[model samples]
Target: MKKLFLLGILSLFLCVLVGNVALGEEEKISIAYIGASTDLPFWITLRNEARNQANELGVEFIDLTPPSMDAQAQKNSFDNAIQMGVSGIIVGAADSRAFDDSLDKASEVGIPVVAVDTGIDHPHIASLVQTDNLSSAKIAGQYILDHMTRPGKVLIIGGVLGHQTGDARKNGVTEVLEAAGVEVIFRAADWLPEKAYEVAQNELAANPDLTAVFAAWDPGAMSAKSVVAERGLTGKIIIVGFDGDPANLKAIKEGEILATIKQDNVKMGRDSISLLVDIINGKEVPKYIPIDGFIIDQSNVDEFLQ
Candidate 1:
Protein backbone atom coordinates (compact mmCIF):
# COMPACT_ATOMS: atom_id res chain seq x y z
CA MET A 1 0.00 0.00 0.00
CA LYS A 2 2.86 2.42 0.89
CA LYS A 3 4.59 1.70 -2.45
CA LEU A 4 1.35 2.36 -4.44
CA PHE A 5 0.80 5.76 -2.68
CA LEU A 6 4.39 6.81 -3.46
CA LEU A 7 3.92 5.79 -7.10
CA GLY A 8 0.67 7.84 -7.40
CA ILE A 9 2.35 10.97 -5.92
CA LEU A 10 5.26 10.60 -8.36
CA SER A 11 2.84 10.30 -11.28
CA LEU A 12 1.03 13.50 -10.22
CA PHE A 13 4.37 15.35 -9.95
CA LEU A 14 5.43 14.12 -13.40
CA CYS A 15 2.13 15.25 -14.95
CA VAL A 16 2.50 18.74 -13.48
CA LEU A 17 6.09 18.96 -14.74
CA VAL A 18 5.04 17.92 -18.26
CA GLY A 19 2.22 20.46 -18.28
CA ASN A 20 4.65 23.24 -17.34
CA VAL A 21 7.08 22.17 -20.05
CA ALA A 22 4.29 22.23 -22.63
CA LEU A 23 3.25 25.71 -21.50
CA GLY A 24 6.85 26.87 -21.72
CA GLU A 25 7.19 25.51 -25.22
CA GLU A 26 4.24 27.49 -26.53
CA GLU A 27 5.39 30.48 -28.61
CA LYS A 28 3.95 33.96 -28.54
CA ILE A 29 4.00 36.17 -31.60
CA SER A 30 6.00 39.37 -31.49
CA ILE A 31 5.48 42.14 -34.01
CA ALA A 32 7.58 45.27 -34.11
CA TYR A 33 6.27 48.62 -35.38
CA ILE A 34 8.77 51.06 -36.81
CA GLY A 35 7.27 54.52 -37.21
CA ALA A 36 8.28 58.12 -37.74
CA SER A 37 7.91 61.09 -35.44
CA THR A 38 4.99 60.79 -33.03
CA ASP A 39 5.13 64.58 -32.84
CA LEU A 40 2.38 64.53 -35.44
CA PRO A 41 -1.10 63.41 -34.44
CA PHE A 42 -1.27 61.08 -37.43
CA TRP A 43 1.60 58.90 -36.24
CA ILE A 44 0.21 58.95 -32.73
CA THR A 45 -3.14 57.57 -33.85
CA LEU A 46 -1.48 54.91 -35.98
CA ARG A 47 0.89 53.71 -33.25
CA ASN A 48 -1.87 53.59 -30.61
CA GLU A 49 -4.16 51.55 -32.81
CA ALA A 50 -1.38 49.17 -33.73
CA ARG A 51 -0.56 48.69 -30.06
CA ASN A 52 -4.23 48.09 -29.24
CA GLN A 53 -4.52 45.53 -31.98
CA ALA A 54 -1.40 43.76 -30.74
CA ASN A 55 -2.92 43.48 -27.28
CA GLU A 56 -6.16 42.07 -28.59
CA LEU A 57 -4.33 39.50 -30.71
CA GLY A 58 -2.15 38.43 -27.74
CA VAL A 59 1.04 39.33 -29.55
CA GLU A 60 4.08 41.07 -28.14
CA PHE A 61 4.08 44.61 -29.54
CA ILE A 62 7.23 46.60 -29.99
CA ASP A 63 7.01 50.22 -31.07
CA LEU A 64 10.26 51.68 -32.34
CA THR A 65 9.99 55.29 -33.46
CA PRO A 66 12.94 57.47 -34.20
CA PRO A 67 13.55 60.48 -32.01
CA SER A 68 13.35 62.76 -35.02
CA MET A 69 12.23 62.70 -38.64
CA ASP A 70 15.72 61.78 -39.78
CA ALA A 71 15.68 58.98 -42.35
CA GLN A 72 18.77 57.26 -40.98
CA ALA A 73 17.25 57.14 -37.54
CA GLN A 74 14.26 55.23 -38.84
CA LYS A 75 16.58 52.86 -40.65
CA ASN A 76 18.39 52.19 -37.42
CA SER A 77 15.11 51.38 -35.74
CA PHE A 78 14.28 48.96 -38.53
CA ASP A 79 17.68 47.31 -38.14
CA ASN A 80 17.23 47.01 -34.42
CA ALA A 81 13.85 45.34 -34.79
CA ILE A 82 15.33 42.90 -37.26
CA GLN A 83 18.23 42.05 -34.96
CA MET A 84 15.77 41.42 -32.14
CA GLY A 85 14.37 38.54 -34.18
CA VAL A 86 10.85 39.85 -34.15
CA SER A 87 8.26 37.75 -35.92
CA GLY A 88 7.44 40.67 -38.24
CA ILE A 89 7.89 44.38 -38.70
CA ILE A 90 5.66 47.28 -39.74
CA VAL A 91 7.33 50.42 -41.00
CA GLY A 92 5.92 53.89 -41.57
CA ALA A 93 8.78 54.95 -43.78
CA ALA A 94 9.87 58.57 -43.75
CA ASP A 95 11.38 57.98 -47.14
CA SER A 96 9.83 55.22 -49.22
CA ARG A 97 13.02 54.16 -50.98
CA ALA A 98 15.27 54.35 -47.93
CA PHE A 99 15.21 50.84 -46.52
CA ASP A 100 16.51 48.51 -49.20
CA ASP A 101 19.58 47.08 -47.44
CA SER A 102 17.75 46.57 -44.17
CA LEU A 103 14.92 44.95 -46.04
CA ASP A 104 17.42 42.65 -47.72
CA LYS A 105 18.67 41.56 -44.33
CA ALA A 106 15.11 40.92 -43.14
CA SER A 107 14.53 38.80 -46.21
CA GLU A 108 17.70 36.83 -45.44
CA VAL A 109 16.24 36.08 -42.01
CA GLY A 110 12.80 35.27 -43.46
CA ILE A 111 10.93 37.94 -41.49
CA PRO A 112 8.19 39.67 -43.45
CA VAL A 113 7.42 43.39 -43.31
CA VAL A 114 4.29 45.46 -43.74
CA ALA A 115 4.50 49.13 -44.59
CA VAL A 116 1.95 51.62 -43.33
CA ASP A 117 1.10 55.11 -44.63
CA THR A 118 4.20 55.03 -46.86
CA GLY A 119 5.00 52.07 -49.05
CA ILE A 120 8.44 50.58 -49.27
CA ASP A 121 9.60 49.13 -52.58
CA HIS A 122 11.10 45.81 -51.50
CA PRO A 123 10.28 42.17 -51.94
CA HIS A 124 10.61 41.56 -48.21
CA ILE A 125 7.71 43.94 -47.72
CA ALA A 126 4.71 41.66 -47.72
CA SER A 127 2.12 44.39 -47.94
CA LEU A 128 1.49 48.11 -47.82
CA VAL A 129 -1.56 49.55 -46.04
CA GLN A 130 -2.16 53.20 -46.64
CA THR A 131 -4.49 55.87 -47.92
CA ASP A 132 -5.09 56.22 -51.63
CA ASN A 133 -3.55 59.65 -51.73
CA LEU A 134 -3.82 59.96 -55.51
CA SER A 135 -7.58 59.54 -55.63
CA SER A 136 -8.19 61.42 -52.41
CA ALA A 137 -6.14 64.42 -53.50
CA LYS A 138 -8.27 64.59 -56.62
CA ILE A 139 -11.28 65.11 -54.37
CA ALA A 140 -9.54 67.99 -52.61
CA GLY A 141 -8.40 69.43 -55.92
CA GLN A 142 -11.89 69.27 -57.41
CA TYR A 143 -13.24 71.00 -54.32
CA ILE A 144 -10.57 73.69 -54.67
CA LEU A 145 -11.33 74.16 -58.37
CA ASP A 146 -15.05 74.59 -57.68
CA HIS A 147 -14.58 77.11 -54.87
CA MET A 148 -11.54 79.24 -55.78
CA THR A 149 -11.88 82.48 -57.68
CA ARG A 150 -11.55 82.57 -61.47
CA PRO A 151 -8.02 83.37 -62.70
CA GLY A 152 -6.84 82.18 -59.27
CA LYS A 153 -3.18 81.77 -58.40
CA VAL A 154 -2.77 78.75 -56.10
CA LEU A 155 0.37 77.65 -54.34
CA ILE A 156 0.82 73.90 -53.63
CA ILE A 157 3.17 73.22 -50.76
CA GLY A 158 4.45 69.68 -50.29
CA GLY A 159 7.31 67.51 -49.08
CA VAL A 160 10.14 66.25 -51.28
CA LEU A 161 8.81 65.57 -54.77
CA GLY A 162 9.97 61.94 -54.82
CA HIS A 163 8.24 60.86 -51.64
CA GLN A 164 5.40 58.57 -52.68
CA THR A 165 2.80 60.05 -50.36
CA GLY A 166 3.73 63.69 -50.95
CA ASP A 167 4.22 63.22 -54.67
CA ALA A 168 0.84 61.63 -55.08
CA ARG A 169 -0.87 64.40 -53.12
CA LYS A 170 1.05 67.15 -54.96
CA ASN A 171 0.49 65.60 -58.36
CA GLY A 172 -3.20 65.03 -57.80
CA VAL A 173 -3.74 68.66 -56.82
CA THR A 174 -1.37 70.05 -59.47
CA GLU A 175 -2.95 68.11 -62.33
CA VAL A 176 -6.44 69.30 -61.50
CA LEU A 177 -5.40 72.93 -60.98
CA GLU A 178 -3.29 72.97 -64.15
CA ALA A 179 -6.05 71.40 -66.24
CA ALA A 180 -8.42 74.16 -65.17
CA GLY A 181 -5.94 76.92 -66.14
CA VAL A 182 -5.28 77.83 -62.52
CA GLU A 183 -1.74 79.10 -62.01
CA VAL A 184 -0.23 76.45 -59.72
CA ILE A 185 3.10 76.95 -58.02
CA PHE A 186 4.87 74.29 -55.92
CA ARG A 187 7.48 74.51 -53.17
CA ALA A 188 9.02 71.64 -51.21
CA ALA A 189 9.21 72.10 -47.46
CA ASP A 190 11.03 68.80 -46.98
CA TRP A 191 8.22 67.97 -44.49
CA LEU A 192 9.14 70.88 -42.25
CA PRO A 193 6.49 73.39 -41.13
CA GLU A 194 9.04 76.14 -40.67
CA LYS A 195 10.15 75.81 -44.26
CA ALA A 196 6.54 75.67 -45.39
CA TYR A 197 5.93 78.91 -43.47
CA GLU A 198 8.87 80.53 -45.22
CA VAL A 199 7.55 79.38 -48.60
CA ALA A 200 4.06 80.64 -47.85
CA GLN A 201 5.46 83.92 -46.58
CA ASN A 202 7.66 84.43 -49.60
CA GLU A 203 4.92 83.46 -52.05
CA LEU A 204 2.27 85.54 -50.37
CA ALA A 205 4.62 88.52 -50.31
CA ALA A 206 5.57 88.02 -53.95
CA ASN A 207 2.06 87.38 -55.23
CA PRO A 208 -0.50 89.59 -53.59
CA ASP A 209 -3.33 88.07 -55.66
CA LEU A 210 -2.76 84.43 -54.62
CA THR A 211 -6.24 82.92 -54.27
CA ALA A 212 -5.80 79.46 -52.75
CA VAL A 213 -3.12 77.33 -51.07
CA PHE A 214 -2.99 73.53 -51.02
CA ALA A 215 -0.68 71.92 -48.48
CA ALA A 216 0.27 68.27 -48.59
CA TRP A 217 0.08 67.90 -44.83
CA ASP A 218 -1.81 69.52 -41.98
CA PRO A 219 1.25 71.22 -40.53
CA GLY A 220 1.95 72.86 -43.86
CA ALA A 221 -1.66 74.00 -43.99
CA MET A 222 -1.40 75.40 -40.48
CA SER A 223 1.85 77.10 -41.43
CA ALA A 224 0.19 78.74 -44.42
CA LYS A 225 -2.69 79.78 -42.18
CA SER A 226 -0.22 81.46 -39.82
CA VAL A 227 1.36 83.37 -42.66
CA VAL A 228 -2.06 84.25 -44.04
CA ALA A 229 -3.24 85.44 -40.64
CA GLU A 230 -0.08 87.44 -40.05
CA ARG A 231 -0.57 89.15 -43.42
CA GLY A 232 -4.27 89.80 -42.72
CA LEU A 233 -5.26 87.50 -45.61
CA THR A 234 -7.19 84.88 -43.61
CA GLY A 235 -10.59 85.57 -45.12
CA LYS A 236 -9.06 86.46 -48.48
CA ILE A 237 -7.29 83.13 -49.15
CA ILE A 238 -8.60 79.58 -49.20
CA ILE A 239 -6.41 76.91 -47.59
CA VAL A 240 -6.62 73.11 -47.55
CA GLY A 241 -4.41 70.40 -46.02
CA PHE A 242 -4.05 66.62 -46.01
CA ASP A 243 -3.80 64.18 -43.02
CA GLY A 244 -6.98 65.45 -41.30
CA ASP A 245 -5.09 65.74 -38.00
CA PRO A 246 -7.32 66.31 -34.99
CA ALA A 247 -6.05 69.84 -34.44
CA ASN A 248 -6.56 70.58 -38.12
CA LEU A 249 -10.07 69.13 -37.93
CA LYS A 250 -10.77 71.60 -35.14
CA ALA A 251 -9.41 74.33 -37.35
CA ILE A 252 -11.83 73.24 -40.04
CA LYS A 253 -14.68 73.31 -37.53
CA GLU A 254 -13.71 76.81 -36.41
CA GLY A 255 -13.50 77.94 -40.04
CA GLU A 256 -9.81 78.72 -39.78
CA ILE A 257 -8.88 76.25 -42.48
CA LEU A 258 -11.24 76.40 -45.46
CA ALA A 259 -11.01 72.70 -46.34
CA THR A 260 -8.76 69.65 -45.77
CA ILE A 261 -8.55 66.01 -46.81
CA LYS A 262 -9.33 63.51 -44.07
CA GLN A 263 -7.51 60.19 -44.38
CA ASP A 264 -9.05 57.21 -42.60
CA ASN A 265 -6.24 56.90 -40.06
CA VAL A 266 -8.26 54.58 -37.83
CA LYS A 267 -8.52 52.04 -40.61
CA MET A 268 -4.87 52.48 -41.48
CA GLY A 269 -3.76 51.83 -37.91
CA ARG A 270 -5.84 48.68 -37.54
CA ASP A 271 -5.16 47.23 -40.96
CA SER A 272 -1.40 47.65 -40.76
CA ILE A 273 -1.22 45.25 -37.82
CA SER A 274 -3.74 42.88 -39.35
CA LEU A 275 -1.70 42.65 -42.54
CA LEU A 276 1.59 42.24 -40.70
CA VAL A 277 0.17 39.39 -38.64
CA ASP A 278 -1.18 37.71 -41.73
CA ILE A 279 2.15 37.93 -43.49
CA ILE A 280 3.99 36.61 -40.40
CA ASN A 281 1.66 33.63 -40.27
CA GLY A 282 2.44 32.67 -43.87
CA LYS A 283 -0.87 34.05 -45.09
CA GLU A 284 -0.96 35.92 -48.37
CA VAL A 285 -1.91 39.58 -48.40
CA PRO A 286 -2.41 42.16 -51.12
CA LYS A 287 0.77 43.94 -52.03
CA TYR A 288 -0.92 47.31 -52.03
CA ILE A 289 -3.87 48.15 -49.81
CA PRO A 290 -5.35 51.55 -50.42
CA ILE A 291 -7.47 53.35 -47.86
CA ASP A 292 -9.71 56.22 -48.97
CA GLY A 293 -9.78 59.86 -47.98
CA PHE A 294 -12.46 62.58 -48.11
CA ILE A 295 -12.71 66.33 -47.79
CA ILE A 296 -13.78 67.99 -44.54
CA ASP A 297 -14.97 71.56 -44.54
CA GLN A 298 -17.14 73.58 -42.20
CA SER A 299 -20.24 72.16 -43.83
CA ASN A 300 -19.37 68.66 -42.61
CA VAL A 301 -16.58 69.32 -40.14
CA ASP A 302 -19.02 69.32 -37.24
CA GLU A 303 -19.69 65.66 -37.93
CA PHE A 304 -16.07 64.85 -37.08
CA LEU A 305 -15.64 67.21 -34.14
CA GLN A 306 -17.34 64.78 -31.78
Candidate 2:
Protein backbone atom coordinates (compact mmCIF):
# COMPACT_ATOMS: atom_id res chain seq x y z
CA MET A 1 0.00 0.00 0.00
CA LYS A 2 2.83 2.45 0.87
CA LYS A 3 4.65 1.72 -2.43
CA LEU A 4 1.47 2.31 -4.46
CA PHE A 5 0.82 5.62 -2.68
CA LEU A 6 4.41 6.81 -3.37
CA LEU A 7 4.05 5.87 -7.09
CA GLY A 8 0.83 7.87 -7.38
CA ILE A 9 2.47 10.95 -5.76
CA LEU A 10 5.48 10.73 -8.12
CA SER A 11 3.18 10.46 -11.18
CA LEU A 12 1.22 13.54 -10.13
CA PHE A 13 4.45 15.58 -9.78
CA LEU A 14 5.67 14.43 -13.20
CA CYS A 15 2.33 15.34 -14.81
CA VAL A 16 2.45 18.82 -13.30
CA LEU A 17 6.01 19.35 -14.61
CA VAL A 18 5.04 18.20 -18.10
CA GLY A 19 1.97 20.43 -18.12
CA ASN A 20 4.08 23.46 -17.19
CA VAL A 21 6.56 22.71 -19.96
CA ALA A 22 3.76 22.46 -22.51
CA LEU A 23 2.21 25.68 -21.34
CA GLY A 24 5.55 27.44 -21.65
CA GLU A 25 5.94 26.20 -25.18
CA GLU A 26 2.44 27.32 -26.11
CA GLU A 27 3.04 30.83 -24.84
CA LYS A 28 2.24 33.35 -27.57
CA ILE A 29 3.09 37.05 -27.85
CA SER A 30 0.10 39.15 -28.86
CA ILE A 31 0.59 42.21 -31.13
CA ALA A 32 -1.89 44.82 -32.29
CA TYR A 33 -1.60 46.52 -35.71
CA ILE A 34 -3.35 49.85 -36.25
CA GLY A 35 -3.45 50.63 -39.94
CA ALA A 36 -5.33 52.75 -42.45
CA SER A 37 -8.70 51.61 -43.77
CA THR A 38 -8.63 48.00 -44.90
CA ASP A 39 -10.74 48.87 -47.95
CA LEU A 40 -7.64 50.03 -49.83
CA PRO A 41 -6.03 47.03 -51.55
CA PHE A 42 -2.57 48.10 -50.39
CA TRP A 43 -3.61 48.04 -46.76
CA ILE A 44 -5.43 44.75 -47.24
CA THR A 45 -2.26 43.20 -48.57
CA LEU A 46 -0.27 44.65 -45.70
CA ARG A 47 -2.70 43.18 -43.15
CA ASN A 48 -2.57 39.76 -44.73
CA GLU A 49 1.21 39.78 -44.89
CA ALA A 50 1.42 40.70 -41.25
CA ARG A 51 -0.98 37.88 -40.38
CA ASN A 52 1.07 35.36 -42.33
CA GLN A 53 4.24 36.45 -40.57
CA ALA A 54 2.54 36.24 -37.18
CA ASN A 55 1.39 32.71 -37.93
CA GLU A 56 4.92 31.67 -38.86
CA LEU A 57 6.32 33.11 -35.64
CA GLY A 58 3.55 31.62 -33.49
CA VAL A 59 2.45 35.09 -32.43
CA GLU A 60 -1.01 36.60 -32.15
CA PHE A 61 -1.76 39.64 -34.36
CA ILE A 62 -4.83 41.89 -34.12
CA ASP A 63 -5.65 44.34 -36.91
CA LEU A 64 -7.39 47.59 -36.05
CA THR A 65 -8.28 50.35 -38.47
CA PRO A 66 -10.97 53.00 -38.67
CA PRO A 67 -13.78 52.78 -41.23
CA SER A 68 -12.45 56.03 -42.57
CA MET A 69 -9.19 57.87 -42.00
CA ASP A 70 -10.43 59.35 -38.72
CA ALA A 71 -7.82 60.35 -36.20
CA GLN A 72 -10.15 59.90 -33.23
CA ALA A 73 -11.22 56.49 -34.48
CA GLN A 74 -7.60 55.37 -34.71
CA LYS A 75 -6.94 56.66 -31.21
CA ASN A 76 -9.94 54.75 -29.90
CA SER A 77 -8.64 51.58 -31.48
CA PHE A 78 -5.26 52.09 -29.85
CA ASP A 79 -6.87 52.66 -26.46
CA ASN A 80 -8.94 49.52 -26.81
CA ALA A 81 -5.92 47.48 -27.79
CA ILE A 82 -3.99 48.77 -24.81
CA GLN A 83 -6.83 47.73 -22.52
CA MET A 84 -6.80 44.26 -24.05
CA GLY A 85 -3.30 43.77 -22.55
CA VAL A 86 -1.35 43.15 -25.70
CA SER A 87 2.39 42.58 -25.46
CA GLY A 88 3.18 45.03 -28.30
CA ILE A 89 1.60 47.22 -31.01
CA ILE A 90 2.38 48.15 -34.62
CA VAL A 91 0.72 51.31 -35.91
CA GLY A 92 0.55 53.36 -39.06
CA ALA A 93 -0.57 56.43 -37.22
CA ALA A 94 -3.52 58.20 -38.84
CA ASP A 95 -2.28 61.47 -37.43
CA SER A 96 1.22 61.93 -36.08
CA ARG A 97 0.11 63.89 -33.03
CA ALA A 98 -3.36 62.49 -32.45
CA PHE A 99 -2.13 59.21 -30.96
CA ASP A 100 0.37 60.73 -28.57
CA ASP A 101 -1.72 60.16 -25.46
CA SER A 102 -2.75 56.68 -26.44
CA LEU A 103 0.87 55.78 -27.12
CA ASP A 104 1.82 57.23 -23.79
CA LYS A 105 -0.81 55.08 -22.12
CA ALA A 106 0.52 52.00 -23.84
CA SER A 107 4.01 52.78 -22.67
CA GLU A 108 2.75 53.26 -19.12
CA VAL A 109 1.22 49.80 -19.29
CA GLY A 110 4.64 48.35 -20.15
CA ILE A 111 3.70 47.48 -23.74
CA PRO A 112 6.22 48.14 -26.49
CA VAL A 113 4.98 50.04 -29.55
CA VAL A 114 6.45 50.06 -33.05
CA ALA A 115 5.41 52.40 -35.82
CA VAL A 116 4.93 51.08 -39.35
CA ASP A 117 4.21 53.04 -42.58
CA THR A 118 3.63 56.18 -40.52
CA GLY A 119 5.48 57.30 -37.41
CA ILE A 120 4.66 59.03 -34.18
CA ASP A 121 6.67 62.08 -33.09
CA HIS A 122 6.92 60.74 -29.56
CA PRO A 123 9.99 59.12 -28.10
CA HIS A 124 8.15 56.26 -26.40
CA ILE A 125 8.03 54.18 -29.58
CA ALA A 126 10.31 51.17 -29.60
CA SER A 127 11.20 51.36 -33.29
CA LEU A 128 9.97 52.70 -36.62
CA VAL A 129 9.74 50.36 -39.62
CA GLN A 130 8.79 52.23 -42.77
CA THR A 131 9.86 52.99 -46.32
CA ASP A 132 12.00 56.02 -47.03
CA ASN A 133 8.97 57.98 -48.13
CA LEU A 134 10.71 61.26 -48.94
CA SER A 135 13.43 59.64 -51.05
CA SER A 136 10.98 57.35 -52.82
CA ALA A 137 8.69 60.28 -53.56
CA LYS A 138 11.62 62.20 -54.95
CA ILE A 139 12.31 59.35 -57.33
CA ALA A 140 8.72 59.47 -58.62
CA GLY A 141 8.81 63.26 -58.78
CA GLN A 142 12.00 63.23 -60.85
CA TYR A 143 10.34 60.79 -63.22
CA ILE A 144 7.50 63.25 -63.75
CA LEU A 145 9.92 66.11 -64.29
CA ASP A 146 11.83 64.15 -66.89
CA HIS A 147 8.76 62.79 -68.69
CA MET A 148 6.49 65.82 -68.85
CA THR A 149 7.18 68.11 -71.79
CA ARG A 150 5.57 71.38 -70.79
CA PRO A 151 6.03 73.65 -67.75
CA GLY A 152 2.27 73.77 -67.17
CA LYS A 153 0.45 73.24 -63.86
CA VAL A 154 0.61 69.96 -61.89
CA LEU A 155 -1.61 68.57 -59.15
CA ILE A 156 -0.18 67.00 -55.97
CA ILE A 157 -2.58 64.55 -54.37
CA GLY A 158 -1.59 63.86 -50.82
CA GLY A 159 -2.66 61.17 -48.39
CA VAL A 160 -4.38 61.86 -45.06
CA LEU A 161 -2.94 65.20 -44.06
CA GLY A 162 -0.50 65.05 -41.13
CA HIS A 163 0.02 61.33 -41.46
CA GLN A 164 3.80 61.05 -41.31
CA THR A 165 4.37 58.93 -44.41
CA GLY A 166 1.93 60.89 -46.57
CA ASP A 167 3.29 64.18 -45.34
CA ALA A 168 6.84 63.14 -46.13
CA ARG A 169 5.88 62.05 -49.62
CA LYS A 170 4.05 65.26 -50.35
CA ASN A 171 6.94 67.31 -49.11
CA GLY A 172 9.39 65.35 -51.20
CA VAL A 173 7.40 65.84 -54.39
CA THR A 174 6.81 69.46 -53.65
CA GLU A 175 10.50 70.06 -52.99
CA VAL A 176 11.54 68.46 -56.23
CA LEU A 177 8.93 70.26 -58.33
CA GLU A 178 9.52 73.62 -56.72
CA ALA A 179 13.23 73.31 -57.37
CA ALA A 180 12.62 72.34 -61.00
CA GLY A 181 10.57 75.55 -61.60
CA VAL A 182 7.22 73.74 -61.96
CA GLU A 183 3.90 75.05 -60.68
CA VAL A 184 2.55 72.66 -58.00
CA ILE A 185 -1.07 72.81 -56.85
CA PHE A 186 -1.76 70.88 -53.67
CA ARG A 187 -4.84 68.82 -52.71
CA ALA A 188 -5.70 66.46 -49.88
CA ALA A 189 -7.93 63.35 -50.38
CA ASP A 190 -7.68 61.45 -47.12
CA TRP A 191 -6.11 58.47 -48.93
CA LEU A 192 -9.38 57.29 -50.49
CA PRO A 193 -9.52 56.38 -54.17
CA GLU A 194 -12.99 57.81 -54.59
CA LYS A 195 -11.94 61.00 -52.88
CA ALA A 196 -8.88 61.19 -55.08
CA TYR A 197 -11.07 60.71 -58.14
CA GLU A 198 -13.43 63.44 -57.05
CA VAL A 199 -10.56 65.83 -56.37
CA ALA A 200 -8.85 64.98 -59.64
CA GLN A 201 -12.05 65.40 -61.59
CA ASN A 202 -12.60 68.82 -60.03
CA GLU A 203 -8.99 69.84 -60.65
CA LEU A 204 -9.18 68.72 -64.28
CA ALA A 205 -12.40 70.60 -64.79
CA ALA A 206 -10.95 73.74 -63.24
CA ASN A 207 -7.56 73.50 -64.92
CA PRO A 208 -7.59 71.80 -68.31
CA ASP A 209 -3.93 72.73 -68.83
CA LEU A 210 -2.84 70.55 -65.89
CA THR A 211 0.17 68.71 -67.34
CA ALA A 212 0.94 66.28 -64.51
CA VAL A 213 -0.51 64.71 -61.33
CA PHE A 214 1.42 63.12 -58.46
CA ALA A 215 -0.28 60.85 -55.94
CA ALA A 216 1.19 59.61 -52.69
CA TRP A 217 -0.36 56.14 -53.06
CA ASP A 218 -1.23 53.81 -55.90
CA PRO A 219 -5.01 53.89 -55.36
CA GLY A 220 -5.07 57.68 -55.39
CA ALA A 221 -2.82 57.85 -58.43
CA MET A 222 -4.88 55.20 -60.21
CA SER A 223 -8.02 57.19 -59.45
CA ALA A 224 -6.43 60.29 -60.89
CA LYS A 225 -5.30 58.33 -63.95
CA SER A 226 -8.86 57.11 -64.59
CA VAL A 227 -10.17 60.64 -64.32
CA VAL A 228 -7.45 61.90 -66.64
CA ALA A 229 -8.35 59.23 -69.18
CA GLU A 230 -12.05 60.03 -68.90
CA ARG A 231 -11.24 63.64 -69.70
CA GLY A 232 -9.29 62.48 -72.81
CA LEU A 233 -5.97 63.56 -71.32
CA THR A 234 -4.43 60.10 -71.14
CA GLY A 235 -1.21 60.69 -73.04
CA LYS A 236 -1.23 64.44 -72.52
CA ILE A 237 -0.93 64.47 -68.75
CA ILE A 238 1.66 62.37 -66.90
CA ILE A 239 0.49 60.53 -63.74
CA VAL A 240 2.89 59.33 -61.06
CA GLY A 241 1.90 57.46 -57.93
CA PHE A 242 3.58 55.61 -55.06
CA ASP A 243 3.15 51.99 -53.91
CA GLY A 244 3.77 49.30 -56.50
CA ASP A 245 0.38 47.62 -56.42
CA PRO A 246 -0.18 44.97 -59.08
CA ALA A 247 -2.81 47.16 -60.74
CA ASN A 248 -0.36 50.04 -60.85
CA LEU A 249 2.16 47.77 -62.55
CA LYS A 250 -0.46 46.97 -65.18
CA ALA A 251 -1.25 50.65 -65.56
CA ILE A 252 2.43 51.39 -66.18
CA LYS A 253 2.44 48.66 -68.82
CA GLU A 254 -0.62 50.22 -70.44
CA GLY A 255 1.14 53.62 -70.39
CA GLU A 256 -1.45 55.22 -68.08
CA ILE A 257 0.72 55.77 -64.98
CA LEU A 258 4.26 57.03 -65.39
CA ALA A 259 5.74 55.14 -62.41
CA THR A 260 5.23 53.94 -58.84
CA ILE A 261 7.55 53.27 -55.92
CA LYS A 262 7.31 49.68 -54.71
CA GLN A 263 7.58 49.13 -50.99
CA ASP A 264 8.44 45.73 -49.58
CA ASN A 265 5.32 45.73 -47.44
CA VAL A 266 5.47 42.06 -46.49
CA LYS A 267 9.05 42.41 -45.45
CA MET A 268 8.14 45.49 -43.47
CA GLY A 269 5.45 43.58 -41.57
CA ARG A 270 7.64 40.59 -40.91
CA ASP A 271 10.59 42.68 -39.78
CA SER A 272 8.48 44.81 -37.47
CA ILE A 273 7.03 41.75 -35.73
CA SER A 274 10.43 40.13 -35.50
CA LEU A 275 11.86 43.26 -33.91
CA LEU A 276 9.04 43.40 -31.40
CA VAL A 277 9.65 39.76 -30.44
CA ASP A 278 13.35 40.47 -29.94
CA ILE A 279 12.63 43.52 -27.84
CA ILE A 280 10.24 41.49 -25.68
CA ASN A 281 12.96 38.90 -25.23
CA GLY A 282 15.37 41.63 -24.02
CA LYS A 283 17.30 41.68 -27.31
CA GLU A 284 18.76 44.77 -28.92
CA VAL A 285 16.72 46.49 -31.61
CA PRO A 286 17.53 49.40 -33.89
CA LYS A 287 15.81 52.68 -33.13
CA TYR A 288 15.00 53.12 -36.79
CA ILE A 289 14.66 50.49 -39.51
CA PRO A 290 14.20 52.22 -42.85
CA ILE A 291 13.10 49.70 -45.46
CA ASP A 292 14.24 50.46 -48.99
CA GLY A 293 11.82 50.86 -51.91
CA PHE A 294 12.10 50.57 -55.69
CA ILE A 295 10.79 52.60 -58.61
CA ILE A 296 8.78 50.74 -61.27
CA ASP A 297 8.33 52.62 -64.49
CA GLN A 298 7.75 51.74 -68.15
CA SER A 299 11.45 50.95 -68.40
CA ASN A 300 11.26 48.30 -65.63
CA VAL A 301 7.57 47.38 -65.33
CA ASP A 302 8.09 44.20 -67.34
CA GLU A 303 10.45 42.76 -64.77
CA PHE A 304 8.03 43.46 -61.90
CA LEU A 305 4.85 42.51 -63.78
CA GLN A 306 5.56 38.82 -63.66
Q: Which numbered prediction scores highest in TM-score against the true structure?
A: 1
Q: Could you estimate the TM-score for every candidate?
A: 0.92, 0.90
Model 2: how far residue 113 lies from native, Å: 0.6
**Least lDDT summed over 10 consecutive residues: which range in candidate 2?**
36-45
lDDT tens per residue, model 1, 176-244: 888988889999998889999999999999988799999999999999999999988876799999998
Which 10 residues in a row give candidate 1 its minimum summed lDDT? 20-29
RMSD (Å) per prediction = 2.8, 2.7
Candidate 1 has a TM-score of: 0.92
Q: What TM-score should be assigned to candidate 2?
A: 0.90
Sum up the clashes in candidate 2.
0
